[model samples]
Target: MTDDRRRRGLEMMRQVYGWEVGDAPGDFFGITVDHLFADIWSRPGLSMRDRRLLLLGVLAARGLNDVLDIQIPAALANSELTAAELREIAIFLTHYVGWPLGARLSVQIDTLIAEHERKRH
Candidate 1:
């Protein structure tokens, strides 16, 4: 992969994950950095914040709670989402995603919001 791709990927990772991309974890990280970020995400269309918000919805719907933990907090920290908007997503999803999954996501989002607030000070 080119140095330019690596640099852009690192910047996107920091913006969305709130951390630097460390030395490659393996081929997976390499592909993610080189292809996913540098190629796909670089395409002109959705903003970074738009991508993040859509990802949050998918993670919540799929019960990918661990990833949601990372994304929800990062999204808020990056100002890609507000606490209120996240809460609203949970509520709106209740009808489509069902109550049990939505309730769990709502709880997790609340916890993440609290965590983000605590880190601010």
Candidate 2:
């Protein structure tokens, strides 16, 4: 049923992003929840951490720092990655993604790590 799928999608979204689902209006949101989260993200074989690492690489490669802003924090909250691991990811990715984008990702990672540390302490 549609409602069941929506519910599943919402739960998946929360699991993936640490986000609380609300009534978001729009076809795009509908598809994102119903299809992307429910169908795609909920599929088996890959762990959430694996999917996140792949996504992080894509986001970093494309220099999508805005999206990374959301993902990196979710990754931390989800315990999918640590601050040191994230920094290492940035460094490793820099060799492939090039310096400018790597720097951008590094800066974002550093900022988020500092924020996470501040919250913890």
Candidate 3:
């Protein structure tokens, strides 16, 4: 994680997710998106959006559906993946990951959108 991207991720965690940590505890090595974004996403070989799609694939393939539900949209929002792009990605996943998983993701995204809307309301 470059200092700049690390700083940005931490700031976003605090501001967006209300995460709290001083010097982040050791338990947080790569438990969530921070490490991936700063370390893997910043790699010269991959674009941020491509990295996000990769992560999304990993999360889905590993049956990390709960985490994917949150990370997918967060990745979209943070990594410049447009909603249409995300929808297309999700569609592509159904063929590999099955309709059930894709449907669950679609529902989860809807839930995230509704929750955000409720907060705004």
Candidate 4:
């Protein structure tokens, strides 16, 4: 259970996404410990696209809009989703979660998208 692979994944998550799996609160600590991270994320069985689908649900369930703001672009960069696809998801989520939330999320997504374009230049 405790191994270098687990440690590496935890560290990489911290450096890349600022996800501190070690200092996680009681909420996430027991829910998704190193075992789950190693078993699921490290597995090659599912494609990144499928992984994003699951992550989206998790995000929505937790009402973590800010995190998803960052995540949508990441999903695109990882080839898990396209810009158009993300737009569609936003549209659909808006209907379900209310426009106010969607609007806020859209603003964040737009910033990320613009930053991405600028970085390419």
Candidate 5:
């Protein structure tokens, strides 16, 4: 059963991040995979995109641009969000999260979009 959960979690990690994932390396990552991904992320209540949007809001509000660096690209690669949609999200977040973080998000979005396009071409 634990193995099954780990396998499901690895798959969920790949699906969520749009990247290849491997077995967890440590206790922290084990929990992240075996529980966070397998159980929480696999829950049926929300679509992946919806969960991502919620996560983005929380990350932005907390000024966690570094995490956004990972999430925005994954969101783009997964087709869960468009560049324009990201820009709009940044704009909307400005009202609630303040201008600095919003600006950071906007800039990060632009950078990630360019990077994604470059990698594709």
Candidate 6:
């Protein structure tokens, strides 16, 4: 069951992030595969799109900047989110997550959007 779940998670992750589970080194990467991807991500209640949005919001609020580097572009490339929606989310999160963090997120997302577009051509 664990293997199946991991495989499914990897597929989903690749579909969204274009990243492989083993692409990076660390126990945390393993946990991301086993727990985040295999466990939470495999749950059926939320659509993948909804989950992506929640992940983005939570990571932004927590100021998980590096993780956002990975997720922001993936969400845009996969069409899980739009540039406008991301901008809106940044504004929405500002009141709750703080202006500095939310503004940082908005800028990063804008940069990633440009990168995503460049890659498509």
For each candidate in turn, the TM-score is 0.93, 0.96, 0.63, 0.66, 0.96, 0.82
> Roughly what TM-score does model 2 have, to 2 decimal places?
0.96
Q: Give the local distance difference test score of model 5.
A: 0.93
What does candidate 2's lDDT look like per residue over 39-86, in tens digits? 999999999999999999999998888999999999998899999899
Off by over 4 Å in 5: none
lDDT (CA) per prediction: 0.85, 0.93, 0.61, 0.64, 0.93, 0.82
Q: Given candidate 2, what's the lDDT at residue 54?
A: 98
Worst 10 residues of 5 by lDDT: 19-28
Query: How many backbone collisions does model 2 have?
Result: 0
lDDT of 5 by residue, 38-95 (tens): 9999999999999999999999999998899999999999999998998899999989
Q: What pairs collide in candidate 5? A: none
Candidate 6 per-residue C-alpha lDDT over 29-89 given as tens digits, one digit per residue, 9 for 90 to 100: 7678767777777788998789888888899999999999988887887788888998888
Candidate 1 regions with alpha-carbon error over 4 angstroms: none
- Residue 60 in model 2: shift from native, Å? 0.4
Summarize candidate 3's per-residue lDDT along 50-103 as a digit string, tens digits: 656787887766668777766765654464565556667677887788788877
Ranked by lDDT, top first? 5, 2, 1, 6, 4, 3
Superposed model 3: Cα runs more than 4 Å off: 1-22, 27-38, 116-121
Ranking by TM-score: 5, 2, 1, 6, 4, 3
Which pairs of residues collide in model 4?
none
lDDT of 1 by residue, 1-121 (tens): 8898888887767676888766476798889988887777777899988898788778878889899989998888788889999999999987777889999999999999999999998
When summed lDDT is taken over every stretch of 10 residues in candidate 4, the lowest stretch is 12-21
